[model samples]
Target: MDSSVSSLIRTSYLEQPSAEQAVHPSVYSKRKRLIDIAGALVGLGITAILTVPIAIAMQFDSPGPIFYSQVRCGLRGKPFRIWKFRSMVVDADQKKHLVRNQAQGHIFKNENDPRITRVGRFLRRTSLDELPQFWNVLMGEMSLVGTRPPTPDEVQKYDSHHFERLKVKPGMTGEWQAKGRSNVKDFEDIVRMDIDYQRQWSILYDLYLIFRTIAVVFAGQGAY
Candidate 1:
């Protein structure tokens, strides 16, 4: 985490109201698991069918491992490896500091990020890179719908209020993605949406978001 962001989190923590109510316990429920399991099974089947073609494309586009895994903060800040298709050059992380961030947050985002390979760009835009995360969902590390998972570094930069977003499991797709994902330049907006989802959570809402995500993915709206 950046020193500046660390300082901000500290300052925000100090300023946060102490009387804020705890996140609803119902956000974590057995019904959510059923949804996750069903979604993951279907998603894994799709992943199985697409794996070979995606692998070949990624290999020809750039030589590296086909899959990428990184530690991401899950429910209540638990660390777990989040899987995805490799969508950048092998040295992408090393080169991250070379480019300016287009998104306004601790997280990095650049629509025209130079480190993205040709095949990777298509995968990212289509959200095909995120396919492997269904395995994470199947394994109980993630849910099919919840808040976007943050990197540990990003979580380290979070304010006290921001921790509320992690009250439920991290997700493959969420309210943020169903809303304008790339169009959301401000991280605070993402946090607000997350908190809202946590507060208003229901199986029906999750289903709605899943269907909405399918529409968003098909339209390729607000995607990099």
Candidate 2:
């Protein structure tokens, strides 16, 4: 390619858009507060209808809470509680680090983590535990598709570039989920995916990730 054409392409494709310029920018204008509201409302309705049976099974199988909530960093480092159906013992948070099943680069996972309950395993495998997060999307604490929200502790470990992910709303699913899901082994790999999404944020990419996520979730591949 000629230098002039290459320069144009670089400016068009690789330059980072300033945060102030991107709030509801035209390239990704389809993302809006109301879209989240309408989508999450319908999603919650479906979850509400399904929750009864799932809740009963969860309660019977485990003697503790039916739901779990944790503080996660959202857009621009804002803190919010991300909700999920309980998929582990009530003491999971307290014991997670002490346990030996922690995964690579500060991620915690184990295929046979002893903390999981019968219902919990199913929920985690099928990602049914994540249903309550639509309320987060409805509240604008998250996007239906974007970068996964990181825990406060996880954020603390991030380098300077990783902070760029906070420039947009945290997502329920995104490039990492659709591409590799739990196979994302290191913090640097995650940072690369998040930066790639931010640089190429577009409606088509979001839609692609959404459909890909559905397939991966159904396959339950690499899920723990």
Candidate 3:
């Protein structure tokens, strides 16, 4: 983790949970981990191939680091640094106040955010910026198919019911990403879909979501 993200880190000592506290079956399934590992290996391979070209475009478009890392709360409110190909001005975080957030509830977003660089816009629209997250999946902090990770600030706003979304590991794509990501502006809807995923989850369902995500990506639908 970078020095900037280190300060926001929340490392905790987790204890064995009681039967009632158990999460979804997918959370601890060995088959799921194997799938995650296989998918991450392929994703990282793509990331590796694109790294050089993406870095060049970023530097040419705006002078800054090639990658961006930020603290995000994972399963059970544990914090980890989420990585992405830099898609904004180097000081975008510092200039956050200059931009107005259009999304409602806990998250922040702007369709026309001025902080995004020219190359960054393309990366985000293509979902290429998320390629690096495969590493998070491989490291066991995330999954190939699951809920979206919440930022520390976002998690702080979560009530008891809201915390249910975090019961599963965050994913590269899930219900929202596969279906309504582009048009779903409300956070509550995301929460509902997340809980629904947990209820309807199965290995086959995960594979379906993964395929749907690929189609969504190719169609260039959804994503800020």
Candidate 4:
């Protein structure tokens, strides 16, 4: 039908380059190096001024590294180290498989995960633990706002449709984080939202999500 042809044309047009292409590079195709540098510097400064004390407390609360780093899938399936303030025991990864899966989508979070340490519990509930990801943002491995990064295993499990998420840089906070986070209990719904982000990505949308994230962080709502 003519309507079907029009729909196809619209989809094709969206897939092509647009005016935003020169200023804002494709998330996977080009590196927005400036964003990485400036955002990271500011983030690092804020983290040092505000989060270092908390990091010190986390170290004292447990006998392990102050920070935790894990290999996460980045743009175009590239692997990058995602940093976070350590909120679990040294053996957390080894014990993860033993715990019941409580996450929605490819994520593996739990509302009452036993692996969380006392300080970790607070950090997670308050989202302070994720402050370290500003470094990832600085390192060009992530963005301040984008789709949540997936693990290698999760990426491997993804269907072809899920690969679209890699078209943009991963983010420290995203639609998922701002919307429901742990409250979203269905994996398919998570994928749907991620796809929706790609279809609707805009600077305004990112800004709106960022403000919403601030509210969510302040309220500490639905976060484990």
Candidate 5:
């Protein structure tokens, strides 16, 4: 949580137009924060209820920590630890060199990555691995709706426009997640949608996206 973000993200973003002008009003809205808190409380309750079963399954599938935490850039490129249910082998990061990246730019994805345990595969497909992120939201490190948090390494390669996406806190689900996440692998397309979301944002719109995310998760559409 005390981690410093890549200088690349902060240095360049500082040179852009003032955040007050570039960032959306929703970012500062008390009403939005209230919703995020309410949603996070409910989400954490669900996660608590599901944790036992998920933990058992994960332990049986692979002997490792039940949760995974990684540092990700948040608003204005502030670095914070993002949490998730464990979705891969214990040494997944160490073995990353063994997998081939299929997505373009800094984002990395391999639907068939061998490091994922059998239970991990299902967790990823259902997005159950993300349940732990409610804690992040509860801690105010993430929003209920905003851009996906990019890793510090990923931010190091970002262009000027990409910095705009970091003006608000990262989210548990956002434009990319509401749309089909698997199909939207191109980093540029994700950046466009994120910025568009900021432009189109309203408190009502955020609620709509949250419900849409539930539908997408149930449908199991475009997850890997």
Candidate 6:
């Protein structure tokens, strides 16, 4: 509920399509939900298999909780707690201002962030840190493929057009993740990609992005 995001939402209301037009058809929405549920069920199984080892490594590498959760803006700019594996020091947020962000705009990114632990770096590189988000997807707070959710602080800085990305549920992997995620330094670029996904969304497109995500995760391209 930042002033800037609120203003953006009001402005977007005037310029964007009506709710009926903006929303996907019922059939498409239902199919997407089914896909999300199926994907999350499978992903949770993998998460269960990896949780023990990952937890042990995280504890040994950095003393903190095994899971990390933060408030993120989701569909229609609603706030939700997005979950992930703890890939950084427990005080990462407290010390965030101590380091400089390499990325442009409100989004923070530091390729060589000191807050990241040894095991954390590997988790980030392989995107294993995002495994816990499958629960979010299964819980209907997120989608399997959609725009990456933004932090409340980041959303506070958004312009009118940037709010368009919040039309759909946020995703664990999306067009940004499928493309050069780390290389995208500008927050505008991320917004553009998210908006693009929204405009061009289809079940097949989502599947394609999901497959692309697997390849990107395996290759570890453009990941810090």
Q: Which candidate has the highest TM-score of all? A: 5
Output the worst ten-in-a-row residue range by lDDT, candidate 5: 1-10
Model 3 weakest 10-residue run by lDDT: 8-17
Reference-based TM-score of each model: 0.89, 0.84, 0.91, 0.82, 0.94, 0.90
Candidate 3 regions with alpha-carbon error over 4 angstroms: 1-21
lDDT of 2 by residue, 146-221 (tens): 7878776676565556666666788888888888877777767877887788777777777788788999999888
Once fitted onto the true fold, the runs of candidate 6 whose alpha carbons sit more than 4 angstroms away are 1-28
Global lDDT for candidate 5? 0.87
Quote model 3's TM-score: 0.91
Clashing pairs in 1: none
Q: TM-score for model 5?
A: 0.94
Kindly list the per-residue Cα lDDT of model 5 for residues 9-75, writing each as its tens digit. 5776677778532666777999999999999999999999999999999999998899999989888
Candidate 6 C-alpha lDDT tens digits along 88-147: 999998999999899998688998999999999999999999999999999999999988
- Global lDDT scores for all candidate models: 0.83, 0.75, 0.85, 0.74, 0.87, 0.84
- Tell me the tens digit of each residue's lDDT in model 3 across 92-173: 9999999998888887879999999999999998999999999999999999999989887776566557777777999999
Number of clashes in model 4? 1
Which of candidates 2 and 5 reaches a greater lDDT?
A: 5
lDDT of 1 by residue, 93-153 (tens): 9999998898887678887899999999899889999999999999998999988898877
In terms of lDDT, which candidate is strongest? Answer: 5
Report per-prediction Cα RMSD to one decimal: 3.8, 9.6, 3.3, 9.0, 1.8, 3.0
Kindly list the per-residue Cα lDDT of model 4 for residues 157-192, writing each as its tens digit: 666566667667888878788998778877677777
Greater lDDT among 2 and 4 belongs to 2
- What value does the lDDT take at residue 137 in candidate 5? 90
